[model samples]
Target chain A: MKFDIGVILASGHEILSGLALTVLIWIAGSALGLGLGFIVATLRRYGGPLVNLGLAIPVEILRGTPFLVQIFLLYFGGPFIGLSLDPIPAGLLGLTVYGAAYYSEIFRAGYQSVPEGHVEAADCLGFGRIQTIRHVLLPEMALIVLPPAVNMTVILLKETALLSLITVPELTLTVQAIGSQKYAFLESLFVLALVYWALVEIAGQLGRLAEGYFSRYRTART
Target chain B: MSWKLFSLLLQASGMTILVSAFAIVAGLIIAIALSALRLSGNRLALGFVAVFVSFFRGVPLLVQLLLLFNLLPALGISLSSLSTALIGLTLCTAAYQTENLRGGFAAVPPGLIESADMLGFTPVQSFLRIKVPIALRLTFPTLISEAILILKASSLVSVVGVIELTKMASNLAASTFMPVELYAAAGLIYLAINQVVTLIGRFAEGRLPGTGVPAR
Candidate 1:
């Protein structure tokens, strides 16, 4: 069957809510990931072997492993750890931890790319570590870093579909639910896919706009 | 749970490799053409290429796979889920590879091409000898990373019932309810595969002429 108007309206409402959940996961997980990555980057930069091994292993594990399994462990392993949790939060936690390991490297790259001359100049002017990052370092590095970081964030947004297996009721989940109910699996799936297509297309356009904007003045955090 | 499932998963590993390898191979071929077209100042060629890249790169892979796998069947253009997955991945990979290869194009010094031209080399010969070699070398690491990302990301295909490593792990998880152990074991397998790929990439970098990840 083709898409019914009533179904469209109802499914659109559900998908909007699902999109909210997807965005929530993307923002919360990325923020947490960035924070964790910052700490890891700083520790590895400052500390020795213990920190090195600790940072390296997680990065490998997170980057190399299938995110599906990570989600599975969080969804099913929750009960054994004396923490009964739902799919959304558990999935968010796992993704955040995993994404953090990758983000740590990006942070490390940005931090290291700070020209020694710039740092020395800041030091010559009596600037400290935090002040150096805030004033001299991040301001310059943001241009180099924003493009890649935004690209990763776009990848993260699309990845939210994987959480449907754990029953998060995200966009894919809502669409799949409608398909099962209506027995119009292919059409419903197509509609949902188009919804995602439109959303991501908008994101790409925004990234381009931001890149162009940053290319002009280069102050704002994209 | 059984040896049968293990064998199925083992067999599916071949499909995963086949899909990813096809994507990489096709990406390289298509991107070589795109890079040539980009070398010319043809607005129509540039615009068409731009649109192609934008559409594929803008959408999520899962959606693309679904559109091909499910939607086409409805339109009476039937294909297996596995074929659909491969096509979707190849299409998307080719688009991004074009983008990277364009960067590779810029990496090739114009002087080298000019020297080739002075030596009576055709445009094609100049591209093959002077442009492509350096571009491929300059772009190898990006290609390697893309392949690795594709491999890990292919795990998402199991959701549509494609019976790969992730599907095997999921089945075992559901059957024996060994969530953590099974998933951990599966994750390690992927890590091992990725490690091997990374090693191969580094080794190849030292050998491939006019190509390499530039050290900063």
Candidate 2:
């Protein structure tokens, strides 16, 4: 009948380890998603109509369906296709692929917002194609892309909780296990909610700081 | 892969649609009320709405559902798994919809409200006839996207024991040992449902008044 903070504190060790795993997965997933997303967006932009169509289909399917289903398909279905993976690897792969679909869309929008004039201007100069992309396109895209990309990262962070369903031993599963074993469902869940809330809040603040840092670049360039 | 298994998935997709429909409608009503509370000049009401939005939006839906699934029994309020799932989804989507509605309302021109006031419309009349409609028009596309989001999110309900499309696929996969076929089929069904939602949204948007297009 009473709420007990002690219940959560008692499982501090497990909670800490779970938190570690959650952060690790989040960072790795974000890095991979961003990198892979950039590649896909580049291909979509320059790969011509047929290549764009090919890339677009998978991205749309990934965006359209639930992450839970996508992860299930990969984790459970992988074995049938001779691509078996352990739970953590499977979860990481799912998160990366899922996050990439969103990030790629963001990048594609960012690319569109960069004017054709800028590209043509870059072409007039002696800059190589890769140099033009590196020096001109990416800088322009970064300003527009940073906010949504951060938003997606926060969303992906929350998604780490879903990895618990596939038995990834992240924060959610850790708390659930503690709740069931210790008979402190309310307290454990309270802790789970608090931890997730704090994580998302921290991610948002970091996003704002990054935005500020990027805006400084904008002002300096001008 | 079998016809019977596919039928089961289809039936489960029906449940997914039903649950999402209830949540989206219920969420919109709650979101509108919450938006009203925010707009109202009462400090206590505004504070309540603020905290409600932050807590619901800050916490992930899965965690919210699990919290309700566990906390409800502790409060001596026993609910079915379906009820728990519905409550969680409705509350979660309500927070998001409230944010969208606030943005929509903010975009409503000040001139229109002032015109309504000069025309001697009651505050309530002006709100219902003018504000709500404009805000709904502005927020329509976002609302449709939110609807699709809730539909995909409904897949999480299976954790609480509701056999939605995703859950049905997992169940069939385990039984038939055909995870590839079952999950792919489930994914395709979800895509089909969302495409239908998108098409309907586009049709409704074109028909919406004041968009310079005539309704059919």
Candidate 3:
């Protein structure tokens, strides 16, 4: 079978639109995940073992299962529970929940990496708990958390491809649709791979920049 | 809750375990070779390994599956659905496991290696007796985590037409219109599998020598 690159090139506008939706979902999902992760991490840190166990169940379940199944459950099973969501919203919700499970673990590690003396120092300075968390903990955790958070973001970005499975019109779906329509399976999938690679690579470079920014104070002091 | 449907999901979960176990074993062998090559100080081998890791790590597994599924047939290499999925998962996980192993090898204290040298241990003996055990101990938890990840990721095989746990659940749901129960059950099975993996990881960590202490 002859492979044709022109088929994909001809469908640039459709692919670009799909890329836009992919990025939009990525941003929203990542934001929701970070917020939820922070809350869960805080709860795990301060909450008793029972509370921790209670919180861990959802995280464990989410982390253990595939994202594809989770989305299927939400999108297909939503109406039974009186909750209905369109494809994009369902994708966003699924990604957020999935990201939260992983990010909460990341944040928990970050929080634990903060020295005990630092918290005591905050207490000694008469800083309230919230103030200590906001000023002392968050800054320190940011340095430790950035790399993993960036990693999770990249994974999340790649996972947006799975959104295509559920009719999200994301980049992967767009490419697949084009491939089937144009009989350019090789060329279209190859392009899809390159586009995802470029996105992940960009995410990596941005992560390095953020890491450098967060660790600047440490470097300066040393 | 029909026992018949539940039994079918269990049988599908068995397929998930089979595919995942194959990938994990195969990936471990490839990862060890790649990690050894990475640490061997051979420029050509190192460069080749670097590209291999990047390509596998950089692309999404879902896309990788699509590519492997479609690209192979174009080249006149027809693979079974399970074979295609195994290749995808093994290659991807091997890349990650190589990195993890590299980190583990690095974490082994330089002083211990120097002492081994002073004791006149041969390079091969030193590596086998001293370095490998320490690295394995240090990397065991991460290896277990990776194993669990591959198990979950094996669900992507369904896209290529292999009906693993997730696929089975979806199939049963569509036919039975019981998406909620089926997906929920499938999710629980995944959780149970991961829990067992985690438990085994912890047990192995406790049993492994030279983990938090020098092998001597």
Candidate 4:
């Protein structure tokens, strides 16, 4: 009944830094995810159906299940396999791998959405394979892909909390530490929730901004 | 201890499947209701539904599940672990599904609804017969995707010691000192069940024939 402002504010200040760590993990992991997604998307497109099937299988399996178990496997189980990463690395690895699966789909959609005329025009202009992809295909897909990539970034940010379970010292873990100490489990968790809400809202806003700016750039190109 | 451990794992997997079944049913009802309320022409109801969906969908499912299982007990509404886990999964799952339903519902052109309205179809009648069927058809793949996502999320119940497959595997690993093997087996089980579900979905879509999607 007596939840003091001072106690909550002080604990909130301590846990606020967890947001920075969350963003850092998201940025690093998502960059890795994007690279892997591009390769997977390309392979799925031109590498034929069986390769697509192989690509699809991992995405389906990872997409179908909850990330919590995947994080657990990475966090606790990695040590048994001679790759004894700490919690942050394992958590990042798990989310990055999972994100790659979804991002590949987004990429494939974007790649397909690029009008055939654009690519053919590049070919007519004497651009070779790598040149066409680098100068033409990538830019066009960027307009379509940027929005969902931002969405996936927002998603991976929230998934970072699973890292807390294995003691990654992220925002949720920090909040959990305070909660268990004061036994204000609800208040402490409520704090985590609001922090997460703000984090996502900001990321979403930035995503919209990026989309707007990118669209303008594409329009200017024409 | 090994025999006891094996039995505990079986119990946990049973619990996992049971809770998942409860969640899928509960979530579908809540999602359909929320989808209706979204188009209810009531500002407050629409606003409330929008906030509920984004809030649940924004946060990680693990965090939401944790709050439900652990926090409500402190707020003087204690439930058993199974109930807490079920409610947690249902709430989050429904929130996510509402958007899918809304999108599916949205894909039915406004013209179609207007046409039905002009034909003297009452709002309720139009929604039930025209909107629901078409929306469900459009959203079949997305719905399958959501169900798979929910099944994965059921693993979080293991964290609160609800002893699902993940929990069972972890327990067996600790007792047997073979963590990797135990988790691999558990992962395989998950992958297998999911593949079955995917196949069934494909078969169902094949039978429907005119649902506007090709079966994968």
Candidate maximizing TM-score: 2
Candidate by candidate, in order, the iRMS in Å equals 2.0, 0.8, 0.9, 2.0
lDDT of 1 by residue, A102-171 (tens): 7888878887877789899999999997898788877777677668777777777777877877898888
**What DockQ, on C-alphas, does every prediction get?**
0.56, 0.81, 0.77, 0.48
The model with the greatest DockQ is: 2
Question: lDDT for model 3, on a 0 to 1 scale?
Answer: 0.89
Q: By DockQ thresholds, what CAPRI class is model 1?
A: medium
Candidate 1 vs candidate 2: the TM-score winner is 2
Q: Which residue pairs show backbone clashes in model 2?
A: none
Name the candidate, 1 or 3, with the larger DockQ value: 3
Arrange candidates by TM-score, descending. 2, 3, 4, 1
Docking class of predicted structure 3 = medium
By summed lDDT, the worst window of 10 consecutive residues in model 2 chain B runs over B207-216
Give the CA lDDT, 0 to 100, for residue B179 in model 3.
Answer: 91
What DockQ does candidate 4 score? 0.48
Model 1 lDDT per residue over B1-216, tens place: 356655555666666667678878887788788778878769998888888887777666776776667667767787777777777788888888889887778877677778888999998898887788788778889989988987887776776677778887778777877667667767777787788889999998778764333533
- Candidate 1 segments exceeding 4 Å error: A1-10, A117-128, A208-222, B1-14, B36-44, B111-130, B211-216
- Residue pairs clashing in model 4 are A65-B152, A66-B152
The lowest-lDDT stretch of 10 consecutive residues in candidate 1 chain B is B207-216
**Regarding TM-score, does 1 or 4 come out ahead?**
4
